[model samples]
Target: MTDSKLAIIILAAGQGTRMKSATPKLLHTLAGIPIVSHVLATARELDAAYTVAVVRHERDALVEVIVDELPNGLVVDQDETPGTGRAVEQAVASLPADFDGDVLVINGDTPMLDVQTLAGLINEHRHGGASATLLSAFLNDPSGYGRIVRTPDEPEQESAADTAARASTPLFGRRVTDRNGRVDRIVEHRDATDSELAIAEINAGVYLFGVSELRDLLPQLTMHNAQGEKYLTDMVELLRRAGSEVTVLPVAESWLVAGINDRAQLSEAAAKMNALIIRGWQLAGVTVQDPATTWIDLKATFEPDVTILPGTQIKGATTVARGAIVGPDTTLVDCEIGERAVVKRSDATLSVIGADATVGPFSYLRPNTILGAHGKIGAFVETKNAQIGDGSKVPHLSYVGDAHIGVDSNIGAGSIFANYNGVTKSETEIGSNVRLGSHNVFVAPVRIGDGAYSGAGTVVRKDVPAGSLAMNVAPQRNLEGWVATHRAGSAADVAAQAALAPQNAVEASAEQPAERTGE
Candidate 1:
């Protein structure tokens, strides 16, 4: 629910040409979420009266995500005018015309802008009682950003250089009274002179302004810069001229407001976010064995004493209980890992592993799979929509799909719950203490009763009664010399002939021995 105190306007209409992708720049994923979501998350935390997204490029796609992420959000489309000022003007118009609260404007591309920093800016502005608060940062190289020029510290003792600067731009000449070190104006990098370009302080593109102050000054913006666009930075000059105190907040870390304009920046932000998340988890008593190789989405939760091993990705609201150890290469998506469960080298999605359960050395658990306490979905096994009861083990090299196995049952290696026939898929049910043997295929719609045993190489198509055994038993037959005949001149044939030579010699000796004894 929105309340009347703050209105956050996220400017997302810019077409990011440097990103060079078919997908809209704001839709690009950063730390497992869209870039705009990072800024939107901050807005939600602020409990703003109006959360407005100003969009022009990829409007439909951007709106879909916006509506999904924030159901009550207001969306405004910027008109044909190509400027940040115009984008924000359209957004502010969408809100209540009489909203006399703070208007927090932020760029859509800066994913590193967190809720705490923004809240701090808002708090500082509110307490300081400024008409507008500007976020600024001093960079070692402020090459491509607008430089922030402040009014003279001593208004009465203006030097010759200062007078020339104030006289050169109409923005500086708008002052009617004495100004004492307020943010005078922002000079665009393309428009700045040599000395102005040397200024290390750059405008951070974030602003907190009184709605009335912002509304009043927005119309005064002019398209006189290199791009012939009414830059939002122009508001600093306009606000100062209107006798409004523009508070400049020099952020401690400039990266907090850094914009992601290319693939390199995207990856850089992701790495920094991952490191921050992992460090936070570690501080909360979760052991991350390899922070460099591990990643976790924002919605994932963990209990204390959980050990996250190397190459683990906990994605999408996954929860790991205390004493659980995940990975050494594992990916879990929207799954729940119970207490003391050990999941190694596995991939599971939307599944539940109960307490003390063990999964994988290469297991693939599909959605709806639930392993009960002390159960094992072991090496090379794949399970889908299967419910494994407590203490049951599907130990190796098996595919168990659309099946339910009761407690203490063991599914043998190379076994498959053949749940699908051509037309539709069915299910297999194995009862308690059942021993399903090696190479068995449980044809769908079949059930094995309690205490039953399935013989090796069995194909179970019918139900087995309690305590009964099921097998497709057949008599063993030997095709004598089959390998020698069929595999002629091969290794088997050579070995067969070598064995026959000894027997042939023994038979000859027996046949000749009688004649030799008689002689």
Candidate 2:
């Protein structure tokens, strides 16, 4: 068997006390994935001989997640969150017994670390004849970072007692009167003088160490600091006393070592990572309009020539294929967009849009909704649990829920497959070439046969036979000559009343004889 030389140790054992979260801090998601996942992905790109993650808090959940999702890697439990030095010691137990090659030590929260930069640091360490090499950077604000110290030259000793005195106050620690000025001893930020605090160079918390050298020096670390923690920085001083060479290589970018301990910092890191992804995609022919308004999860895929317009948030395992256009303002979750499909101003969840299909300027495709090839879901449409057939059109003002539209059918404006009847939902199936009119409602469990025509305002309750026109309204009739008969009866009654009126007047005059003579 060929001998493998390199092993990677990831420092993930910290509980992230500053994070103050119930979820393991390393398991916290950034851009739709756990933070440690990004770190593991970066390490995998290096093709290290072995990868070992040092885990402490929430070990079981982290193990399951890493083992199931992450590439094959080893996990070692630190059991106790003692310190970074102790964490590495625990992981070292899992390394091969006779391993003698270089080791890469990295922090799990530093996902921004690029494998190329890490590889370059390791290469420099191997060539510098140094026992260890640190990935260092000069930050304008280096408050919490350890400062890198280097040895200059040895001073002449007068005698053995003098050597003991000088050893008590090493020449490296003494202020050197150089041509420029007196050089102060390199000190950590907490213990540094005001002048030393002004120094910019800092440890990046990433290291490349020779395995044998680390094995020898790890046990020498003591818990002597104010925090009662075994600091890895103190090992640098120890190695110096042992006459071993240590080098610091400034990281090409300072953000490579940035770690997240709080929500705000996590957000900042996520934004930076997303910006990197967007820039890379832009350089690769993917157009992301208004990058600030667009948020693409890190794992989401966009093929070449795909355009993501402003206000588009493609997240949660979604992928848009080549030539597709998504959103002037749209949200997609766990979805797949086919080639050249247009999903505009829509919200889709667990949905798939087929090739060349067009989904609306105002539409919602809920879970289990699938649009067939070249299907159109026009403006103000909503679909749930529906399967739209190929070349079918569910145009304006429609809710196609719990239904299946056959190929090439035209679902009219204001048409609704009213599949819910208070208690349960059912399916409405329309065959090919069925022309549904406006204001049509297909009640639950009804199938419209092929070539069936429904007039406007048709409420289809039952299945219509093929080639039949189903109308739900009654027939109308016209009435004539009815008014003429009623008018003739009124005229005859008026003449008979006039004839009776004269006789009545004569009888009245005879009843009063005196009045008759005067007439």
Candidate 3:
């Protein structure tokens, strides 16, 4: 990089008319971050002394995002006179006067421009001793891009003999340059002549200029162009006219210089960004089962040897420790997964799972839910603001909230911590080694002590001491003949009659013997 002091000016003033939506183009997100945020972050990576972003359309919204991303950065609104040159001028006026550092100017919508390229461009500028440096790309169909006009000292010498060779040569996407060392001028596609339109080199909307040089040349710009705007590209011509070296840097990875102007381009840029992220994780010793189906956030992280399964979205600062297996249809946001734990087909937010804990084949863990080591929150379970101790298990089909369960406790299937009493949400505490039966409901503000047992169908409303067996106090009763009576002449009645016939005959025989003896 350059040893000189550096600052950056980001152009975000365009209306993005082609995006055709109410949301500002810079606010549209890819990989969970606003687009200009990516550009700001990349710019900050250069360790610039200061950074300024210029905004016009949607200035307030763009300013909010920029301040959040780069808190110390400056945001200046461009005045009504429209042009990229005017935007940079407004940004430059915000910086310290007499600051003779190199200023990097870039478009905010071009988020895919990486830091390495910017650093290389700065190095080229400082080492080449050029007055201004611009990044350029060679596109196969460079329509709508401003064409780079090299000095005519080197004209095309394509002879008839080599015409076949020139056609056969592939220029699909590669950087080719000449030793001209300077560009004469730049022509926008709308204003270019037929001969100039055939040029493959196009401006990439990234430039490096000496601060004094930019401050000198910007005021000379006029609204004489087709758009009646003062274009920043006109500076290249102004610098050349003053006998200054206006150098151009050709980037080999052209997509790094690509700009996002519409929905289709946004999608393409997203795919390219995701591909880079996935490959980075793969190279870092994390196993990604299906890269195509997984979406990992820029803030999310994984330790070495973690396995990420398919159809998963791990977003918002979520961290998975070593040896953890996650996904195969799961979403986790801002959560922590401990070492060797397995999370399958679950959705959790703002929660933490301890080491070796098992969560879900289908579970919902809401905010503040924390499971201790070796704890299991199994299939179809939902938990919120609950703390379950080590070796405890809420196996299946339960809703646990505002509760704390001690170590080695077992919460049976279909049990619920009835914490909400229509208005007030209450708490439930089950002590260590408790055995809670299926279908039990713990009405809250209640506690079950250590080594206690609760029978099935019990609704616990009060406290139970240690070593006690709590159950409903009602005695069991038989209502055997009620179904037959209520369902008379039906299947139950017929079966009941058939069953009583033989018994009735035996009773009659005994009665007859008794009668005979009496006589």
TM-score top scorer: 1
Write candidate 3's Cα lDDT for 1-519 as tens digits. Answer: 433489999999999988898999989987778889899999878878889999989898999899988898888989999999999888888989968999999999998998888988888788888999898876777898998888878565222243223321121121233563479999999889998888877889999999998889899998898899989999999999999998887676668888989999899998888888889999999999999999987888899999999999988899999999998899999999999999999999999999999999999999999999999999999999999999899999999999999999999999999999899999999999999999999999999999999999899999999989889988989987786768988987898889988998999888874334553
Stretches off by above 4 angstroms in model 3 are 1-4, 20-22, 155-175, 192-198, 474-519
Clashing pairs in 1: none
After superposition, the stretches of candidate 2 with alpha carbons farther than 4 Å from their true spots are 1-3, 152-193, 418-425, 455-459, 474-519
Between prediction 1 and prediction 3, the one with superior TM-score is 1
Q: Pairs clashing in candidate 3?
A: none
TM-score of each: 0.90, 0.80, 0.87
Tens-place lDDT digits, model 1, residues 261-295: 88988989999998999999999999999999999
Candidate 3 lDDT (Cα, 0 to 1): 0.88
